[model samples]
Target: MSYFLSKLVRFNRSSVVGAVGIVSVGSTLLFSDDDTRFRTFVTARLPLPSQDASLLTLAVPNDLFPPHLPSFGQHGILSLSSYRVGPGSSSDISKEASGAVHDGSKPCGCFGRDTIANAAAKVGPAVVNISIPQDFYGVTTGRSIGSGTIIDKDGTILTCAHVVVDFHGSRSSSKGKIEVTLQDGRTFEGKVVNADMHSDIAVVKINSETPLPDAKLGNSSRLRPGDWVIAMGCPLSLQNTVTAGIVSCVDRKSSDLGFSGLPREYLQTDCAINVGNSGGPLVNMDGEIVGVNIMKVLSADGLGFSVPINSVCKIIEHFKKSGRVIRPWLGLRMLDLNEMIIAQLKKKDASFPNVSKGILVPMVTPGSPGDRAGFCPGDVVIQFDGKPVESMKEI
Candidate 1:
């Protein structure tokens, strides 16, 4: 290959190119910038006897190192623009001589090709495709597609709660039922066995066909950015699809889509997750499931979110017993102390009214917690259980 062509190939180490070079009766040789195995090619037009069988060696420093191992059993040279070669004409040729394979350096897993394939094969089966019937108006018009991970041999599927939430026109019918589709294309009826809207996690139950393929859940608590990860899901309902990328970010609160009232924490990733990719499993290079894929802003591409698998497990266990996620509540709706409200308070006596700080106790329930806690009109509550107070929105 020409020096210019080889230089272009240097920038793209993963591509293989084909070209021609010339062999001369007088030794004709070439050398790479740093003794790297630039690439292999094929060509004709030898300067020497066509059947000479002489090896044309490229010069390299004995102490220099190459970027990666050259392709084995596939290395060949080609003849380029030379006096003996007809212009714009070339022939196919093969070399019996082998090119040296470069083992670039450690931490470069170029040598771990088989290891990565085997790991993916082992974990791919555990990532499942999920389908839920979405009820719009009074009819079930379509289905919501997402992904899930089988967490038990008896068939307990764990997925994002938002993937299965019923959007009934009225609160009375929000209790509509949900169904789940497995990776094998078998669809089964499932109920919202458990749902934590705050954490956006849900668990579904399907009858065991045999032993279920339970995923090897890993600890997301140990995750960090730039760690290699594989997101396995049915994005757009494509079952067992795998995309590889580095962990873009961890413990991100910015992209959270759960209830605005909750302390939402999430794992942010740049993996290509699209519609129907939600509720999948994000696994580390070790083939361990780390996070539960959850949400993505529609306007943003390449932005995906997942709830830490550790948090999902805890919420699932909590829902298993409590029937609902338990969250602390002060049960008051307060108005903010804006400039106008502050000016009014300043005009009042030294001890401003309850509306100055606490939830403007609009109308308390007759015998509820607010009434029993001495939370009545004209009383400003500056704290809740020793915690500094904010608007009831903080409750």
Candidate 2:
């Protein structure tokens, strides 16, 4: 609920700069001085607060030059100091008395504390914890915990495809049993209706005796970077956990990140999400579902990914009608041009041209549309439908 600014220091050698100020977010620092031969030294340590009050004081050395050299400027040495006075301190009390503090706890006529609390109260009931039982050879192997959002009054739940899929990377059939737990401690048997691996989305249905609470779907296209978002899920088997963060990016390509089995674009956020958080809902400030938590980068922190609600809506409609996604197939086997492939190509034939980027077609199906369109083996597909194609996945 409380946010604090973290300081970061960067060093540059190309320019001679002497100043002290708060660095802006994502700002670049450059130094350039052609006349002076300067050797800069930088040392940084974590700030320590005072015991009585959270007051951070940083002292920088004034004498930066060696004893052999004379002072260059009006001051022989420069000393820079900074202080960070914490909340509730004397400085903050003065600001509060002056009405400079913005009270986030009060309603600001918009998405304030009251609105966020009301949104959570309205949507929390619809977020359910999903437990999937993996059965192999008639015996129970193991189980996986995830999260889902009820999308229909009749108990239709929407979750990630990976949640319903078995450990062996196979979709769960109707016979497979899944347990859905509501916030009220009620449990129901769920059946997988349809799942799409490419889009990483699945729909489950549970025949509830009474009507269930459903979440309102929102437009993901309206989401911009820095927009506030709340993620609700059962992370690490903790039920009904909620975390808040900002939208990190709107359109992150899965292929660009070396991630397969994902749609072309995905939503990225900094929300604290964990393993069991998959298939949960990423709600906007208005309490509308904007995305579905899918995956997080294991090697990085706070790099959570989600499937946009708009894309999921399209997939849900398609699955509802056809029970499966029908994808257009291009009968062509191609490889992305890279350094290794270029090296191999040059070794195979000295006449091979040095191409930086393109999809190299190793073979084209004989009777397919590609062959009919005069495509042949060893042909490079630089573009598709007028868009540049760098990878076969893009095509």
Q: Please report, in order, the local distance difference test score of every candidate based on alpha carbons.
A: 0.51, 0.60
Residue-by-residue lDDT tens digits, candidate 2, 70-121: 2336333322121111112222222112211122444333444343444455
TM-score of each: 0.60, 0.66
Tell me the lDDT of model 2 at 202: 80
The candidate maximizing TM-score is 2
The number of clashing residue pairs in each candidate reads: 10, 4
lDDT of 2 at 392: 55
Q: lDDT score, residue 81, model 2?
A: 22
Error of 2 at 35 (Å): 75
Instruction: For candidate 1, list the clashing residue pairs, or say none.
Output: 20-78, 20-79, 20-80, 21-78, 21-79, 21-80, 22-79, 22-80, 23-47, 43-78
Give the per-residue lDDT of model 1 (tens digit) for 1-395.
11111100011111111111112111111112222232122122322222221111111222111111122233223111111111111121111111112233234333254333344555665666666554567677556667788788888888765566432211122245455666556666665566554465777777866887677777887777766666777755557667766677887752133222335577878776655566778876555788887654433445567778888777766666565555544433234344565455445433444333443333334565555555443344445555656553444
